[model samples]
Target: MSTKRQLAQQLGVVVGFDDPQAALEQYRTPPAVASHLIHLADLNDDLDGRTVVDLGCGTGMLALGGALRGATRVIGVDIDPGPLETARENRRRVGTKTAVSWLRADATQVPLCPDEPVTAVMNPPFGAQTGNEHADRAFLGTAADIADVSYSIHNEGSVDFVEAFAEDNDGTVTAAYQSSFDLPRQFEFHDADSRTIDIELFRIEWA
Candidate 1:
């Protein structure tokens, strides 16, 4: 059996969100985003023994990557159960020695440990939904609330959006990187006709 298939079997059945295939179809992480995350984590000297959170952690790619990079503990959080199940299965398949945990919860209302500092990485929804502006704002607001320092992914065109987020929370963008990604057919709203989508990865710190 393929590794992914074997993982699905070992994880039993997922509830809430659709099965693995559906989840993959609708919510796969873009390769550029993944690469940027890994690069940012590698550049940070504090990641070796720190706790990190992967918000909107579809399939745990970021979380697993963090573990491989020597984080003391990596937590993957998502609202949907299917993605959580897939993340757990991926964790098992990779078989890393670093600690990894998956939590099924809304990203906007993450329950965090009060005493420990956390570094978070997230690729939040980019307000592409026709009428879901509020959802996207809430997601960003929650991200700022939960971490000491954060690296967030957003569309390159969202300069105003990012600036507003930083302004609202007394944070500043310490660094930014650009990544280009292909839009998957499942997310047709992205509407790239053979063109790569430009995305920005911003390192944010509160003032």
Candidate 2:
């Protein structure tokens, strides 16, 4: 547990975007959340000998954690270039030769390699911003199409919607964990220094 906490702290040292785009709903997943989810994946044997993708992988927390935990291959896809640059720097800092790939592509459009079974972990947009509403559906839909199993975080208020979406895609929620997602003040929208959002971590298996 101490090692895991240390890893999370190292990953968090990389700064997130200085100017986060609201249209993309860019918020970095907290270090604790990333560590907790990665530990759960390790227990499930999802990190070994598997190809993993981190959708909207801001600063590469989930992707790097997967690599550090022994995933054979990990891919991180993000639409924003700012965070992707930061993620690459973090990768070098981690110093793993795990064949991690970073792509500057939208999560919904990231292509999967045909020969490998893919598992995805993501903290997609909560769709709170005016134009980005329901954007989580796009990431979920893409994951359902490409991955055998997926772990994603969603707003607590959207549990029903997430369940229905999973069912619609021939997927089932095998496990769900609840936690508080920290949203720090990034943009100047006249908000507090930080706020916590109730969130659910979902583990889904695709049929």
Candidate 3:
């Protein structure tokens, strides 16, 4: 089994969006964070021989991570075709034998119905932008519809919302960990050249 650090190194080649849309909160998920979450999911025996789907999969960091580890198949869904193109380039950059598919569709509305066990990995928008509050709820709803289990990254102090949503949807919060998102000044609104935001990772089992 590849350690987290090794997985990070493997995912280091993933490229970020060429032109990020502030409305979408598009950003490259840090290799370290992606590696840690994927590694944690692997530890839970959630990935191997399973269909792993990455929602809002900017440049395919998490999706590619799953492929590198031992997932039988990986599908990355995103609304932007630009990032999907970059994700295709990234697949070749991080050479692997596992099958991977990139679909240009909204994460919240992707038409996917996998027949095998499914695991979702997503770094969705935190709804920091105007008119987008509670954006993660749509993603969670889609996850509940598609995946058997999911690992998601969210803004800090999301436990109550996650837990309540889980309960309402016949799911359970199986595990949680504190993590950080290393963000860069890719958009005009960013005040600093770089910032590290404290975040939380949750593992939920959907029924």
Candidate 4:
């Protein structure tokens, strides 16, 4: 297991902790998603010395994982300043070899290099709380607009939603992975039950 995975297992770290700010201060990492992200990075064939941008990069899980996996440069962007600050601190603590940078910006409107080839990865909000497909679609559209390839994670039942989003943006699904994510009790709207939900990671390219 990777160091981060081992640490996550030891600490019982899960995605969407009860107190995100406090969890971030504790340097909690999302192990399952991080492992999946590493797999995505390896699948990219072009990952070596490539530029990568991670949107909604919580606690630097994906960003730091990309750095460790030999990405030449990794930029993590998030709207929440608290998580961004935690990611910065974790980057310093790990002393990642690859150049890692953090930016606090709205994921939907951040400026990106349109001419340069880049890979974008993100774990966007599931939109379950508000059932707002527009937000998810907008995120995918923004990603397609800026990057040559994009990998996004969403709820398992959102396959149709993603397909429609890709279609709307003239993009194609290159790959996908379905896996379970353990969300913390505090993050779920349901009672104090273990929040294990299936999620899908999709790799999309411009059509």
Candidate 5:
């Protein structure tokens, strides 16, 4: 098994969104964060030969992580065509043999229905913008419907929300951990060149 830090180094070549949308809260997921989440998921037996879906897979960070770790099939879904273009290019840059399908569609309403075991991975929008509150809920809803297991990143204090939502939907919170997200200044609201945000990672097992 590769070290988590080693995986991060491999993903350092992935590019971020060219024209980020603040409403979507589009920030390039840090390589460390992506590696940590995907590494843990792989350790939990969620990646090998499984059908992996990366919801809101901006620039294919997590999606590529799944491919690199031997997911039999990978689907990268995002609403924006611009990032999908970049993600396709990143797939070539990484040069993984795992097959990846980049689909331009709303991730929260993914157009996928896999018959085999599925693992969904995402660093969804944190919903910091006005009127975008609870954005992660929609993403979770899709995961519960389509995946046997899921790994998601949320704001630091989302344990209660995630637990309740899982219980209500016949899913279990198998694991939870705190992590940091590196956000380089890309939008107008930024007051600094970079900021590190406290975040949480959750692993859910769906019924």
Candidate 6:
């Protein structure tokens, strides 16, 4: 029941680097987009009283948003230590009492508690950068391995790929939402101030 503005307020207060390593694929998820994805997952009745994992969580947008949205527990996992530091700071700033845990580890390698039904939400790399192809596949495959339901983001062009990937991993795409993903020029790769890419939020449920 949180408003987008309210969610943004909670996430926008935190700060992060505009661009980080391409291997990490660390584009900060926009506040509105993070809110929308989390909202959609909540609408699907997938979050309340559940342990929510924010894989590749950058700056804690999805983690903090899920905490704010009444999740029973929230774990923000990332391979990079920098963003995980930022996530800790953001967690302290938000002051959410939802049993939040920040773990610095690869999303595909993170350990899950046994007998706990987990749900994952992430805005992973779209695999556009050099040497980073099929990055989203790892995240989706890991979610399929450990999560009951997952909400993930991908480029519009990868719609067919995502669907097939989900099906192949014992999950089904129950829903997909399209939105304009704003990409600010962060890296030194000659570009404009910002650009918008068509992105899709896919809701995948384990079969």
- What is the lDDT of every predicted structure here? 0.67, 0.85, 0.94, 0.68, 0.93, 0.85
Q: Candidate 2, which segments miss by more than 4 Å at Cα?
A: 1-4
Q: How close is candidate 5 to the true structure, as a TM-score?
A: 0.98
Expressed as tens digits, the lDDT of each residue in 169-190 for candidate 2 is: 9999889899897688877783
lDDT of 3 by residue, 82-153 (tens): 999999999999998899999999999989988899999999999999999989989998899999999999
What is the TM-score of each predicted model, taking all chains together?
0.80, 0.93, 0.98, 0.82, 0.98, 0.95
**Cand. 2 Cα-lDDT:** 0.85
Please report the TM-score between candidate 1 and the true structure. 0.80
lDDT of 5 by residue, 1-207 (tens): 678998898899999999999988988888899999999999999999799999999899999999988899999999999999999999998888899999999988887888999999999998888899989999999999999999999998999999999999999999999988767888877999998899999999999
Candidate 3 Cα outliers beyond 4 Å, as residue runs: none
List candidate 5 segments past 4 Å from native: none
> For residue 40, what is the lDDT in candidate 4?
65
Name the candidate that leads on lDDT: 3
Clashing pairs in 1: none
Instruction: Report RMSD (Å) for each prediction in the order shown.
Output: 6.4, 1.7, 0.7, 4.3, 0.8, 1.4
Query: Please, what are the lDDT tens digits per residue for candidate 4 over residues 139-198?
Result: 787788777778887778778878777877888887778887666554334486666778
Q: How many residue pairs clash in all the candidates, one count each?
A: 0, 0, 0, 0, 0, 0
Off by over 4 Å in 1: 1-26, 187-195
